[model samples]
Target: MSEAATRTVTTPPGLLASLDPLLREWLPRQRWFAGKGRPVTGFSLVAATELLPSTATLGLYHLLVRAHQPLLPGHVGAEQPGDCYQLLIGVREALPPRLAPALIGHVTQGPLAGRTVYEALHDTRPAELLLEALRTQARIGGLRFERDPNREIRSGLVPRLVTAEQSNSSIVYGDTFILKLLRRVVPGINPDLELPLALARAGCPRVPPPTAWLVADPEVPAGAPQPVEPYVLGVLQPFVQGATDGWELALRELAKGEDFVAEARDLGRATAEVHTVLARALPTVTLGHSQLRLMVDGMTERLEAAVHAVPALRPHASGLRSAFTALDDLAAEGHTWTAQRVHGDLHLGQCLRSPAGEWSLIDFEGEPARPLAERRMPQPAVRDVAGMLRSFDYAARSADPPQPEWAERCRAAYCSGYAEAAGRDPRTDPVLLRAYETDKAVYEVLYEARHRPEWLSVPLTAVRRLAASGLT
Candidate 1:
């Protein structure tokens, strides 16, 4: 880390006067910190709302912090500062020995300099306050807790922080309700909340609807040109009883050398059911010549970017580009595509198989790295199918010696089931499906190259196969 790693905060210094130094060291250690490997240039206090009055035995605070990172080379606009994050802070007179791990270091400066501070979500007492606030639909300072009127959150449910989570902090209340607190708070409507509500309204049973949600709607500065985007603080949903995520289920089956085609078929059907409901509930669009051109252009652009990011992709760039070009050819020949709201980022890990042998989808938040607006935009349902296919490929490759045949069998079965439920065969549109699959593989190539170099072969194989010929 360079000395330039210091955050050059944009907001007034007073807001974080006490916790600045502590957070500088603390934020980077968090998994949800988006600017990892980059120097935190500074911070701006977007909003700091006290959930409880200072006189309380345990003072709770909700803070919206913007962290700025130094620009990266050849990355346009990366130099711009401020990626917003949400934090729950619990202040106390003394830190308990058992809660030492949750400490954010002692606050040595600020109006409350002598107080001890830690992550509130880690402490059960403070964690329950969040639920209480939601149950009562309370507003403390700038924070607002809203609930679905038709739903009820039972009382006396013990709160436990889910430690294995990435990107956000989740608290499960006695295995009844799960609250996912958004760590990197983005300004706009979050798909995690929006999609589930729509699905629930459409009576889509494959997903559990949001029971309640929390948001921060701060007053914008006078004369600001744009409306202040409401920050999505957190969302509460019913906890799936005795559920195993699809990824785990697939892995277990792989280890057992058992056929997963049946389960895969069921998952595919559930996916199609959700898509059908989404298409009917939300706005749908038809991609004409111009729209298809834009879609192809975006895919090509991503391929070019991935090639540069991961040198291993350079060799297959031309072959991959052909897939995108084929989409244009289809449009030129009078073929049109339908676009609808989809699970923008779908994978086995994002689904759960219940004890009743039912498949339910979770996490409608799409790709977290992409802008919220893009995640919400209607796109071809095949994009989601492509994602699931890639996930199957990953599962097979991760197995001992790899099981290409098993993956192929499951893939075919899944698609067959999807066609049965969707009333349209995805294989019939090989050109569109292949393009999306190639794009997904390209994304995996870049991701695996950066995070798991050894795992590069998984997606690299798909890239070569997709670029060279048809899905085997």
Candidate 2:
């Protein structure tokens, strides 16, 4: 078993002497290691940022490793990386007087806050680098990380911010640049590393263009083995300033009973457009039925476990079972929807309405629970559209608990939108769209009931409708 499969421990002193040299052993011990749970066979340094002294461990490392993916490739595996992704990591700059609490072990600039190099940012005068980040907008997907909060009268210099998502707390200069420390890493194409480039290349009007990437070169530093693993990562792109957050925006529209008629319609069109582009860029590879069967079987087992986890979710097991059935049922109907690469998770909250009245998409990372492999599968574009419809319904249900009328409107607007783009021709007879919608609703019910109880109404309402209408 690899240390990745083991619990991460604080790095001891002697091992910290040479940060790079020890990383091969220590890196695997850390939680941020991206390469699934596979044992680290061997690793090579791909990139390193040591402009500072080796003792100064508070820099970043980009490491690459060769590991096993078990019966498959690294891209398709059960082990997934934790959320905190960054190219920068904190290192011990000097021998500790005794055992510095804050400066102990190489940690996230996060863990070493007021004690190490990261602490200097909050000092009376920040590092000169702060001046640069403060003055200009650090672009990463229309999100500019800035220094001046429009409140701070100090050195307008923006301190190179750590991502707000960090546990120790990195300030959000202006939500532009998020200095997320690499707390967990899963080997393969970093979504943050890969998404911006792909979307930009595909001309998917929503995401920002890739500006510059921060990577680690193992050879850049002396004897680093895991060079390609880019420990601390940050990507800067143009910021979409003053834009409303999609989640909040969705909530407001639902409350106002604002029929997202046109918006939903537009959403359908946008989804279709993006799918065409994604198919072109990623291109779909035919998924073997054996693989599909295994995926469906695995999902069934997982959903069964989920039902067991939360008793309220047990009733949903039947509906959940339906997803598996639907997969087979549809194919049985002689309307097999080929699996292809897809935007795993899509919903209203992942989209925004710019001041210019156009739809903008964000969060290309797919479903939070589904393994990356399943999420990357190209199933049906209708799945995406159905998710949005469920989202719209969810908003309405949450906003007006007493009104099913609103839910009805959501369903109409969404399908109206989807139909406009995907042709709504019911690829399968007897209008399989209802079954598609039901399939999505059942998923919504199971997922939201567990994660967001308050949002359960969206799927519940859809379920009621589905049960009443019959699963096509």
Top-lDDT candidate index = 1
**Over 4 Å off, model 1:** 1-13, 54-56, 75-78, 470-472
Per-candidate TM equals 0.94, 0.62
Residue 58 shift from truth in candidate 1, angstroms? 2.1
How well is each residue in 1-472 modelled by candidate 2, as lDDT tens digits? 2322222222223222233333334444433344444554333323222222323434322223333223324356663332332333334454344323223243333323332322232321223333343334433221223332332323342434432232222333344543332233333454544655677777778665544433322223456455434232344454455666555776777777666567666766766666666667775755455555665676566656656655656655575566566665555555444444556567776776777776666555565344544555566665666666666666665664555576566556656665566665323333335545665665666667655787776566666555554444
RMSD of 2: 10.2
Residue 114 displacement in candidate 2 (angstroms)? 10
Q: What is the alpha-carbon lDDT of model 1 when measured against the actual structure?
A: 0.87
Candidate 2 versus the native: TM-score? Answer: 0.62
- As a whole number from 0 to 100, the lDDT of residue 426 in candidate 2 is 27
